[model samples]
Target: MAHRKVGFGLRGIGHAVVNGVGRLGYASRFFLMILIGSGASFRRIHLTIREIYFTGVMSLIIILVSGLFVGMVLGLQGYETLQKYGSESALGSLVALSLVRELGPVLAALLFASRAGSAITAEIGLMKATEQIAAMEMMAVDPISRVVAPRFWAGVTSMPLLAAMFSAVGVFGGYLVGVVFIGVDVGSFWSQMEAAVDFRQDIVNGVIKSVVFGIAVTAIALFEGYDAPPTAEGVSHATTRTVVTSALVVLGLDFILTVFMFRGV
Candidate 1:
């Protein structure tokens, strides 16, 4: 019994270490490819533009609607709390700060992970299983450039734009709640918000975080999809892993950005 327990413990530790190292190695290689321009092809750029249009722009409607509701809820809740403290005038600043500094990027990343990450994973996994990737390689084509580069750049490029859109819609939502629903003065709300929030740092941080998240999501999805086993079950597993891992990475990056942005504030 003692020997068996010792062996199990050792095996578990080894598994954990291996998984950690693998993830780190994957991230390093993905970044290195981008840095070294390992796969620069005209076909890749065209495909990437198509993907950007689909994954980024096509996703705007859902993101906007979701942002509107989130902002409305935040304003409503913040108003109620501030009312209790007789600081109702602070609602605009609160909403703007929250949306521009954190919620906008994080929420958009989550939405993108669900919409784009899953699609990329499924598409690539299908290609892998159907032997399309193999066929391309057999034709002396670089699959990374043809397949992965476009999706990776699309994600990185779209994330910041999506974050900005989310912020704009969220601000409008808060405006509606404050002026129409809560009967707060429009001028006062805007003035207070402008006074309280620093657009340079706060908004910039949000946009930067979105780009980083994009890179993480696209890389994870592509890596998992490319490495998927040659089976239907493997494709399904890759899809799930892509979504879950992207979501976790988005949240983790959010935390890191928050810490760095507000470290001394």
Candidate 2:
């Protein structure tokens, strides 16, 4: 009986592995389809612009508020820590580096995933559930070219800008807490940050992270929606999956990218 149980367990494991691989393969093909269909978004431009209004503009208030609060917290905590070592002036470097190099990209992406990513999945999934996508198909309209591609491109475009704004606001918040509230030396704060932060290594890499994160989150969201079962329950589950999957992927990618980008530096 034990031997038979072990065999069953092994078979189950193998089946799971194969199932995961097959899903990955399907998702990859879907990503390519989105890429090919993306031409309509670029050619028309208005469709993509409309998507941007939803995914980007509608998301700005949350992004702005979150960035400010995060920066203030960082400035306070960083100041306290640096003060213990009599390095309070380095607070600016600590805050700036924290935001630009890691927190800014990671947190911004997380917020984007929860907010915009979930919305994309829910919208597309609803369209599927309601037979809108099928209606488009019946009409000889390429639904992907018309529907999915614009949102995909809009997400890719908006992520970098949102990340930049997050980092920028965070820096200002840090300055407020450290300089105005705590009375840190203004000159030392800015100078230390300038000296420590490398444009190419830190700033550019952060932007790259934002872009990659954007692609990953948007692709996952669109795929989940497209693959969702045509039901209300399916759409809801897909929306939940979009946020959860995007968060996990963002964190994993952040670790991998950090190792590659910051290793040996």
Candidate 3:
């Protein structure tokens, strides 16, 4: 009995590994197809706009509020620590660096994954489970063009906007804490930020990172959802996997981007 149980467990593990790899392969191929088809379906502008309105603009409140608090905390902590070393005047530079280089993009991606990724995963999974995708196929409608394209564009377009909002709010939050609570000189703070950071490279890097993160999130969510097993339980599993996997991918990508952006300097 013990031997049989052990063998069964090993078989289960192997099965899971194989299934996981197969799902990943399917997702990769599906993403490529969608990417190709997206360009060909130029007449779907209205659908794309609707997707942007729903997925991007609707998620603004959470990103802005979270960013504000994060910046306030970072500024307060950084200011207090720097005060001991007489570097408090560098608070603006510190805040700007944190926002532009790390916090802004990372936080926005996390929020986007949680808010938009899960929704897309669940929606697609449900459609798959209910055979809605099949019905669309039967009706001669390409689901990739109708479903995946809009989401892909929405994710890519929204990411930059969300990242910009995060960076702006974070900087404003830091300024509020520095001036109103920490007693920092407003002019000195602004001067330090202006002198220390290059807006061009920082902004460009942030926007680029946002676009990458958006694509990743949408791709992962759609892949998980479209490949979900044919059951309600499968839909739930897909949603969970979408959130977890997207979050991990975002973090991993952030590290890669950071290394590339700051490799020599």
Task: Report the Cα RMSD per candidate.
Answer: 1.8, 1.2, 1.8
TM per candidate comes to 0.93, 0.97, 0.93
* 1-265 per-residue lDDT for model 3 (tens digits): 9999999999999999998898778888998988887963458588888888878998899999998998899899999999999989899999988898888998899899989889988988999888999999999988998888888888888988999899899999999999888799898899999887776677788888888998999899888888889799999998999889998999999999989987877
Clashing pairs in 1: none
How do these models rank on TM-score, best leading? Answer: 2, 3, 1
lDDT of 1 at 123: 91
TM-score of 3: 0.93
Report clash pairs, candidate 2.
none
lDDT of each: 0.86, 0.95, 0.88
Could you tell me the TM-score of candidate 2?
A: 0.97
Off by over 4 Å in 1: 34-44
Winner by lDDT: 2
Cα error of candidate 3 at position 141, Å: 0.3
